[model samples]
Target: MAQSSSGTDGERRLDLIAMGRAGVDLYGEQVGGRLEDMGSFAKYIGGSPTNTAVGASRLGLDVGLLTRVGGDHFGRFIREELEREGVDTAGVRTDPDRLTALAILGIRDPDSFPLVFYRENCADMALCVDDIDPALIARTGALLVSGTHLSRPGVFQASMKAAELMKRQGGRVVFDIDYRPVLWGLAAKENGEDRFVASAAVTESLQRILPLCDLVVGTEEEIHILGGLSDTVSALRAIRERTAALLVCKRGANGCVAIPGAVPDDLDDAVVERGFPVEVFNVLGAGDAFMAGFLRGWLRDEPLEQCCAFANACGAIVVSRHGCAPAMASWEELQLFLDRQDWPHRLRESVELEHVHWATNRHRDYPELTVLAVDHRSQFDDLLAELGAGTPEQVAHFKRLALDAVHQVAAGDPRFGVLLDGRFGARALEAAADLPYWIGRPIEVPGSRPIRFEGAPDVETSLREWPLNHVVKCLVFYHPDDDQEMKARQDRQLLRLFDACRATRHEFLLEIIASKHGPVDSTTVARVIDHIYSLGIYPDWWKLEPADDAPTWDAVQAAILRYDPLCRGIVLLGLSAPREELLAAISAAAPFGLVRGFAVGRTIFHEVAAGWLTGVIDDAGAVAALAENLRVLSDAWRTARDARQAA
Candidate 1:
């Protein structure tokens, strides 16, 4: 690549700011079986910003690379690679002793080519805007940013500086909200909710920069978190409310839709038409490719829909090949992918069974199981007595409802054992027992209190008699009065109960009430968890709060943070508990990625018939619902955990 003459700050051309990359990616041919099947693997530029820069260059954009690579071989490779791809290296810098980002491409499964990232102390993590010439950004056309650049001590400031410079000069600032949950370091290993709250400062960091962007790109998933919105329309509403940028959300296969205009349209009737679906390739650099295509179209003043189509075409090509950019197609090559559907069809159809099995595997390693219903106000006598006074036939029906829940889970997943909010009563349990298949050996046995963690008198006897996993029921309290007496009870008597069961094999739980939890008052909760674990015990999960009322966001978070056995989200206790409070708690915890696994007995069973209404309150039906809900919670827990780690 030829070096451009040092020009005046006002006359620079295409001085792009690819502001967010902390590592380097090396692509080489795949020799392994898994690699071979995922298509030929070739070493290519890896960072999203760098990849976008390369793609733009290939598309005839005069682009500059502005990322910090380490003084090591990896960093050197990144610089060399970018230069070869026709990118301007005027902004590249080196850091001695600091390593460049490195990733190993291993095709573990042909279905998805996993790129194992190695990014502990890379030099790029040290980039400062001072490293880039201010004159360059003053004359640039667009500045690009990816989410990865916002991490610890230094790089974040550096990336932000360049973007601000570009914006100040009336240039366009582009954002790719490719939020990586893992690196955000929310609830991963740091200290639960408190640490999560602290780490969530990323939101503030993003707000500082997003306002400067001319356009922000994100997927349906990323939009949900950054914009705190669910569907496409809501995401646009939220983003537009937050920043003055044109927000474009990438919808895979279903096509892409850009929120029309800079302001969100209340014309809830605002028009949004879908773009065409192109084939999905490796998906590694698709977003970058999309940016490349979109930018090319934008520079030409193309229509919004056409811009999306170009981006889609670019993404389709990159995904089909290996790496982020070596295989990026030209304008004409992009058309070929958009016109075809066979690759997309084969990719989707070939993985149904494989995905199911993989899903089962993940459940074992990462479980997010939650049980709803059991709560503090609940007593065995109360639940048993109300068995929805019914005739013999109706009673039998209730039994079947409960039984179906237990049996369904036992049939599908080996790791699928979680407590049930059993307020629906014995009929539901009976139905679960009636189920025929035993997917795996039962984890708990019937009619037994869980074995305590420590030296409960005669603890050995309890362990011998009760099989822990089969209990499949978690106990919780929706609310606990904030009175000193209640706090004392939890700290003393309840704490002792936990103490008693520490080392026993009959492991189960009596979760503390959450909804009613108030002011810190003391450090008892955080302390007790350590005590319980010290006795070689693990809580299956915690219901988090009371069943009757919604838990305060802080209260739910504080409780969840105290323990570390991958507890599910707060379980709802009140049958009539309004979901609004839960929604608030959910929103509070979501940004930090602190929740997912949840349960509630009252919320589920209270709405239907008290006794067995064959249609409304059948026991068999409850069992089925239980199984489905368990799987849902388990999946949620797993996702948060995986994303946190990857981020």
Candidate 2:
């Protein structure tokens, strides 16, 4: 068994380096629609090597990708997506000369999918020898190169160079026979769905690098093309004649067979690790998923049987979901699936499976937050009415100043964030767009009893227009003891908002103010969250009125951790509490790790905002006042946090 080395600090070396294409996959949303007739598509970062790299990272590998994308918006998107998935992008370069690649695919039926590639000299194919870093290659435990990169001259040289570097460093070289017929010019330009074509030139090109690989993987058709033979066993033998690399043949639903030695006369002479029986939704990226799962075990020096099991389960899961990279399972999700005694044929329909996927796939971490809660629409309107001299425009400007105060307190720090609403704070939201603030935009109409969205009749449709960085914040005023009808209506709205957030890939912060509906104790607050969780609503963050006792915070924390351990920690809401009370609340909750930080609006900015609106203070005076207040609260939080850590 081969294993990767570790540094003196005990962190393992890079587990795998994948070199090849990176592109955007536009998967047609209409299940049975043709590519020409499909009106909507879901965009996901894709390409064989790219998907494999993301999948490996999800499966807990220190993976990197060596590819090139055009200096365009899609290029930046590719790099960002890879980084979000925890893949090292040091080797992913930008090709100024070429555009990024794209594939437009539609599921005509489970078996008959249509695809058209837009790769007329794509940037990924422009990956040259200049892009291959020997030092980067030497740090990897394995180099995995796809057949698509070897189809072109420049990319072929680059891939070969990377493979040689890995081999020189005593790292394994894994080859994925990612054979695409149209890519090799063996099919019509529109025929990107065509998987294989027999070409002597292709066989010779692949054989040139076969001996360089320690492990080789391919489907039956891909093996036929690689070996220039029609029969699977015969092709395996022919490949074995050319190289001593271990051969793994993917047999789709029938699972896979691994041949560590000679090619068997009959495939049955080898052990076939069976795959999970899943109803296929789209099979376009299953092979890449299989490769990812196999490498997850292989890099850990797990046995071939275990590797095949991981590979088969991964392929099965991806086939039951839409898109490629997004459908790839996390290691925890995989464990849940394997550990379960019964699974639905359509894995996509499993709520538990989808929840696990949603929870674990999120790469962003908000360990602590000190956010300025300026998302008060109704409160701002009341304030304007009280002042009688301020316009909506003035309130909007006030929100912008609040954002500035936030900047003054903690500029360039992600832990500090803002909860700004679109009604009066739209300008503030726009200004904070380019900043590193963890912006949370409100959708719930300020203080709606049953939860009505402000401007969005259709929440999911409206979320499509929002920037991906903006977390959706919705506040529901409800008691667990509310009337059955009201509870049902509120539950429906929250569920709809949650589903929309999931669809749009936005983090959700569910703010509960049960005191608005009825007398609220700490236990009542905990019941509200537990009740929501029981309804299968797992929000990324919870915004609750500050509780000054440990028991209440403990109960709330236990409920959250029990329901969704991946739930992003809670943030304390101000609710116009005085400075001393808010500080006490922060101090009380700080000892428990679940209480992340405070989003106190009134305590930090109410006096300043009122003074500014009533002409009692200048903009600089207002900014200074709010900034100082925020600094004090932040200092208190740090002191409590540091005390907790020391204890």
Candidate 3:
């Protein structure tokens, strides 16, 4: 809200640099359960500065995180998560001596959240003077330092060095009073839930850096600890005396008060912005989210009132949801939330808002795909039966060979993928996870007309164990003209599966085989897709049979876009067609751009698997043959794509 002429340099790369902790958060999934009784936990990126970095990035700010994490998988996870959120990670250093910080949190009630910090000698705390990059501090337009980093002497010096460098460059310095007494050793190490435990040392340390800050944000308790006074107004006055920095006092449900000038004698006279009144589910990372939202506007020189409104709305949205960083809304979603005056008071229950969140926050892009579909269950069993000597182990090994073929032709390629099932290809699935290929797993029963999930009685429970990167794929044979009862049952099953994927944050791929129920015309597939979308089920991907003509592809694209313009596009399916015919279909679909690529299964794998099972080929021979077949198809798709682009 204040101008700094030195910060207006055109060469600065980032708008804000968040300097502090970077770590992982494991939140208990079971609500109303004690931390000791928790059975499962959901992993998310955490730490106050990390959350603020992600939040600011989501709201369209060019932000960078300046912190350290351990040289471990969890540390790599933090850096990758920040990068995915569009935050620059050039300043994210890896500390080899200590592990990354971890926080285990659980929600027992609306008012009670149990937290335990495992940050002793953590990597972030090991941030020393050498980690501070003077060039980075000079180039940033603003610097935000969380108070937790200032608790220990070593990191406190690191924080102060960055702040002083930013001050010397005339860049803005923001202070988020992220005080936790347990982290400061003022409370029992086990009591991380305690937000406030005053210490004269903590107060004195904060007063030392107050003069350098351009803006200071804290809850009432944090302000009290900073100003060394018990009264809110007196604390505000005392803090005002130390620095002319604008103070944003966060008042948890009521709203926040921004005192840009001197403290008013009466608390009611402060400039206040009202917060959205919503049902609070968990308030763990709401303050971090608030700071993120505030900076989204603050760094852009927006009005302080507008900045506070954005901050309050963001905090409100996260408190009504689940984990911290993942719960932050995208800029588009936040605007929609504010524009809709009659929105459902419960933000989580609004389908429109949830869809916006899902669509906007998805950072990965798949412009094209070439996937091998080896997830056919009953067909593999039938092949084994015809061989009369093969075991399930052989099928599993053959599946692995298929994966090897995929790797040979398209290793490290994001466009190449595999669609395999856990029934017979469990070993193959395990091996595929390490590669950079697009991995999809099927859950549909081989050929249940009304749709049934394999392996588990409750599909939702089974999905909890799936890796977040694996897309959930389901196949159904349905005709628009089917009997009403049968169609309704299939619709209900599809809805349930889609809901499960949404709940678990997995992408959903719906494969429709309309020809199985009746003869398919050019328009038949498009009609079935329209009917499904009419039922309010918008899947992330649509896998369908390729159309013979341009008009048919046009009809399908129109139907998909009419419902969800952001759909992940379609993938052409191969139903055991001849190689020549499949190539022709690829050439036809290539020009449309709506068809992403192809998932041709039996066409490429059937002969190789059959030869391997019947003793006509060894494992190496089968792998080579499968690789050759897939290579031909992949080359054909590329040629078609090139030809279309040239035309």
Candidate 4:
């Protein structure tokens, strides 16, 4: 079997191979405004072939792009962007002689976006047949070539060669009548305005390639250009006469139509016009996104109706957001959008939709977190006694005030996270769900009662009931010298918890504490971690006390990586240590990449809690005090982390 060098197991087996234009799009960021007055712009990977490749990849497809990029910063940017999205760039050639193409797009309104293409002697247009790798084409399930690239002789030959190779190797050909007339040198103005003009030469070139394609996709305007007919029905008939490929007509807002083989005698019988009505922002990349969705369903052998639905959803999502490639939705995001069922209207304001968008767009890897651990049960009792207020209502009020302090500290900072519990922090946890900060819910009860989880009877049920955004933090107190039977029981319990976490898809943070029964040393911690891994228990994050030294932290990190390289890294536990000491420990750990951040508890707000209970400070004073301490710790951690990264 033919294979691409970049493919896994040395087999080509690509879901889609795209050969055409690849460029950077500089989109104006000013919404509800004109292009001239736009103050800012965002850069995104653009072009029909590139957008399709990225969109399909986002939907979990193995895709590759075959194009040329100038050996410049923009070219590097394009390559990196594609690589980040899991698009195979092995076929992306770099030309030292030319510059990468760029598109300056301005959003004047939803219906009108001004665009100027800077592709005169651009690297992508210089694509040659020599750059075509026949083996790679053969490995792909489908080879996609855009109409713009087909307009030029050099790129046209490359696209033709790729299609021919793919057909000979039993791969399907997908032709996107992308129809960019500005590239044909027919639409030029002194002010760099974009215009489209239908010409016989353009139609002839497209028709020559149409018969070789197994599928042809285009918008109504694109079809008019290809078929040389103004009427939609006439255009479909003309296109059917030239190619036996499946035809897909993309009608913005009104949905799309997909016809198998030639145009049916009754065109209405073949058309599928289901689509989500979305508030259009910029319609530039919606077609490419639509193609991506259709291809995802088509390649998966889904029903034509379902494929059109996916296409429409994808197009709706892109049109509602900014940029092209970056605005494409992942499968999870798309599913959430579909589940809301509030389409053809303003659904962007829905919190559920926003949550899905944020979660899906967040980085897959663990982010740098400054977690504040305030899951104190006994500490609250001590404060209540000091204040002489034991009523349930008063206790709840105090807890609410403390949680408000934490919220105040975390407000405006996305890096901040908090660890709360169901006992005293239940209300806080509920509130945290609506906030942007990460929330860690503790599973283990406080104190050293042989490391029992709080609410043991409902541990599994509670974990299952927890929100998907929350992390489950399990603190286990174990000693190497403990009674063997007791140790075995604890191990069993931990294994059960780990399995439960895995089953529920909750990220686990294992907080290991070496009891007085064993030497509280780094070696002991490392042994415990190794033993846990041996039992097939790997956690996403490690919550540990400050290591005795830098070497101790290094040893712990080494063991963690050895067991699970993908571990989310360690966070230093406060253990009620003095503020100065905790800060020092954090500074030491901050130098290591394996140390993510700290989760300090009492050190931050213990004094404030005491003061508030004794009437030495008001509620506002307490909140202010906690915020100050949090800010100090957050700044210290950032400084240390930034310095280490710089070094």
lDDT of each: 0.53, 0.89, 0.89, 0.80
Q: After superposition, how far is residue 384 of candidate 1 from its true place, in Å?
A: 99
For candidate 1, give the lDDT. 0.53
What TM-score would every model get versus the actual structure?
0.47, 0.96, 0.94, 0.60
Ranking by lDDT: 2, 3, 4, 1
Q: In model 4, state the lDDT of residue 236.
A: 85
Count of backbone clashes for each model?
62, 0, 0, 2
Candidate 2 residue lDDT tens string, 337-366: 889858999888898999899888886678
TM-score of predicted structure 1: 0.47
The digit string of per-residue lDDT tens for model 4 on 65-119 reads 9999999989998997787677888799999999999988888876678777788
Lowest-lDDT window of 10 residues in candidate 3? 1-10
Clashing pairs in 4: 3-12, 277-344
Give the number of the best model, judged by TM-score: 2
lDDT value, residue 507 of candidate 1: 32
Q: Tens digit of lDDT per residue, candidate 1, span 1-647?
A: 12243455434366455765735555535533543354533344577788888777766667887777777766776887676666777677778867877665643433454455566666666776577678667656788877667666577777688788877878888888766554566534222111112223665566567788888888777766666555556756767877877777776665566765653444223324354443454567777888888887776678876787788767765665556766555544455445655545433232322222112111112233344332212333344456644444443454345345544554544333323323333344333343332111112222222312322354343334433223323333323334555444434434344333332323344455332345432343334445444443345444344322224444445654554424433332333455455433333343334443455444444434353343554555556665565444445445545665577
Rank order by TM-score, top first?
2, 3, 4, 1
